[model samples]
Target chain A: MKTAQKNPPAHSVHSVHKTPTNPPDILAPVREMIQACIQCGTCTGSCPNAFAMDISPRGMWRMVIMGEDESITEELFNTKTFSLCSSCYTCTLRCPRGLPLTDAIQALKRIQTRHYPEKAKKNIHFYASFLESVRRHGRVRETEFMTLFFLSMKNPFLPFSFAPLAIRLMAKGKVKPGFPSAGNGALDPIFQKARELEASS
Target chain B: MKNFTHRYFYYPGCSLEGTAKEYDISTRSLMAALEIELTDIPDWNCCGASAAAAQGELLSLALPALNLAKAEAAAQASKSTAAWDILSPCSACYLNLKRAEAETARNPALRARVNAVLAEKDLQYKGGVQSRHLLDVLAKDIGASRVGHAVTNPLSGLQVAPYYGCQCLRPYAVFDDPEIPGTMNPLIRAAGAHVFPWNLSARCCGAAHMNTHPEVGISLVTDILKAAKGADLLVTVCPMCQINLEAYQNRASRLAEEDLHISVLYLPQLLGLAAGIAEEKLGLALNLAAEKDFRFETINEPI
Candidate 1:
């Protein structure tokens, strides 16, 4: 039922937090966005997986505004709803307050993957595997990517479930399971710098 | 300025090469027919797709910024034309590149941050090049009449639903009204196909959510296909939408208990078919469900 924040109020009814005495450069935008939230529950209600989400979007926004850092981090790790966002931008579009819900959730996801790699392994594994391929070849080598992706999983046999589909695809020549040549040299240094920034940040 | 008249740099993102090979073939074939030469962004990197930004902010901007730098260099190097337009066929790539351009243009702070990271490459994203979706180029630059004029075999009876997956329409209102984009309707009609009113044309087919949460993605795809129930097939721009709808239909059917047999076709392939290109040349035979569900036996005949 394509729903929207029918009539958002002036401010979130949830109590505001006073814990943010100081904010980092990265979190500054998050803080500004936190104030912009209307607590309309539209994001949570509109979320395709709200029932499955451990921390509803409304609850997550409330925690962010309250500066309940520890609780928010725990919720992110335990519920993994931030990881479930498909970047559909439905919440961002529907937000009467115009909060960038997708980016905020992904920012939390970055924090989650950074702090709890073990818990966020599934969420970040493909990302790691994909970047690894891109780093080496500039372009994504699907063959190399698949090998890295499946092997990274504790149970490698899981990929076999999609074998029937893969075979049909191979027959149709949709898949060329081989390492292709890397792309040009333009982005190599930028990628290295990004890696360095990620480590430092 | 993307007044793409004769030629422009094209970024055929990774999915086009792998999962959507038919899209690649059809795109190349159709571009040839249209006399549009797409210089591949030499050695283009992954546009830091749905994955990169989730991990690191700097990585997200820098990845696409590098490609823009390359396209800029190409445009500057060409003395004949000042056209510095980068056309990305994949919706994710198009959105990411456009986001990079807009982000750099809108927020000087973010632009400075991204440029600081790019300094090592002697690169700076000055944000002059125009980014456009391929459909926009075909619609605006190539013009509908020219496209219609090239059509030799009109698909007069084929009932089609144009699917515009999420990434292309969201976050920005670039080419068409995101809500009711008539971008593909004109092209489909030019090819002589029956355009059905598909309500889910702008819906998301769960995107990469299919990877993390298969059930969620499958259910979304089910809804999209179920919405396009009366149509014989669905035509889309994104490789993800096409692959997801075509490959995962049966799973969604089992889960939703509906006969979701709509074969997914790339817009280029349909245009190629209507332009009288052989099915083999345009890679229609490679479409996972097109052969099984589509009634194109007569249309597949080589002109």
Candidate 2:
């Protein structure tokens, strides 16, 4: 029932400059997938976290399909609508257009990270810390990953917010205390090759 | 001598080693009791989870591709001509692996790109390995009747709610009805527990949002917990759902202004108990809510 804001906030990330008229190449697949959207609003209706989103899923799609002014796309990116998606795929399942709505939302997140890392700073730090853990160790060590994330945030107070849960989990032996190590380093070659490929492409 | 009926390459993702260790323990114990042989995918790495997608589609695909390629190589090395199945207990890991399998199978261009990255590790995923969730294998491959036959202690009188969460069901409706998943219903019944009717089975548990955005995550958890108030325990197939539902009860209670305390357990842990595998083996003590909120004695009757 929440309504989308018509205009971007004055202090929004891209308020200084208009976004490019054409969407990024990364969004081409998503654009093709959603071009058939009839704006039935089924995605918005089925979304569990739509209330938390600034713009409804339907509204985001409408902007993409309409390919209107640069400001509209700027407003679309400015909103945390795609980031709020839980990847539940409910919206994708219910979309009458059979569009990959969830994947499109995820692509929005990728686009945010690729084109606007400054705007997606917090999300970038969070996911980077997680993947860094995986890259270092063959698997993610939760404590190590959380510590890296907290350190990356540079927010000294942030650790306290999660301290109670961490303490409880540690006390229950759910999480073991350990320093991060070069766990087998088996995945290093793959990660190196992937980075090389991505950079080249 | 026990005759093993089925063999699979087990991929216990990162969470299974830490927060959701109990899930791994219970699953291994339960599967062993059912005469299922699980071989760990040799040198398997992280699935990149929901995070890697932010880096790039290639990294996300490549991360799981490494695991899938490893499984395929392991299968070939063992000289097993039959196709291999990589069984992931964590829903996130299953989804990532399955996505890699499905994407690479249909898109040869993508397959080449992913295999190009895999060539670094001297691995090439040929797309024969099947990525499966434990629920899918249990519901379809190992039917409820077989599970029932293994139960030494019936979980009679226990009211249980099956929580499918997301990932496993959506966008892939592989085995069960995505919206109204009944795959776990027969499994729950097989353990001799009454299926507590609830509509929030396929609902989202907010996944990693609990860490990134606690307010949104706690609100969703509160709603799901509120809906599951009547059930004695909520059973989940996803490690993320299990942790989010079990870990945030106090916060969810405060947010909702109600004492929302429900024992949330992995489905395998529940079945492990019914199969009369020792509670210690099932890692029951590791569960945050199970110790304080759930009582095993209430349903500890031999059928």
Highest TM-score against the true fold, candidate? 2
Tens-place lDDT digits, model 2, residues B1-303: 243344599999988988888999999999999888899998788999998987788999999998999998888889865557989999999999999999999999999999999998888999868899999999988889999999999989889999999999978889989899999999999999999998999999999889887889988999999999879899999889998998877777778887778788899999988999998899988887784436423321111
Error of 1 at A124 (Å): 0.8
Q: Could you give the fnat of all candidates in order?
A: 0.68, 0.82
What DockQ results for candidate 2?
Answer: 0.44
For model 1, residues A1-201, the per-residue Cα lDDT tens digits are 234376445344322442467233333446575677878899887776666567798887777775545555455457667777878777777888887888888777777676677887866888888877887777777767766778788766778866767777787777777753455545577777877876875
Quote the lDDT for A179 in model 2: 69
Model 2 misplacement above 4 A: A1-29, A180-185, B1-6, B292-303
Instruction: Give the Å error, residue A165, model 1.
Output: 2.3
Q: Please give the CA lDDT of all the candidate structures.
A: 0.78, 0.85
Q: In candidate 2, how many Å is residue A190 off?
A: 1.9
DockQ of each: 0.41, 0.44
Candidate 1, clashing residue pairs? Answer: A184-B43
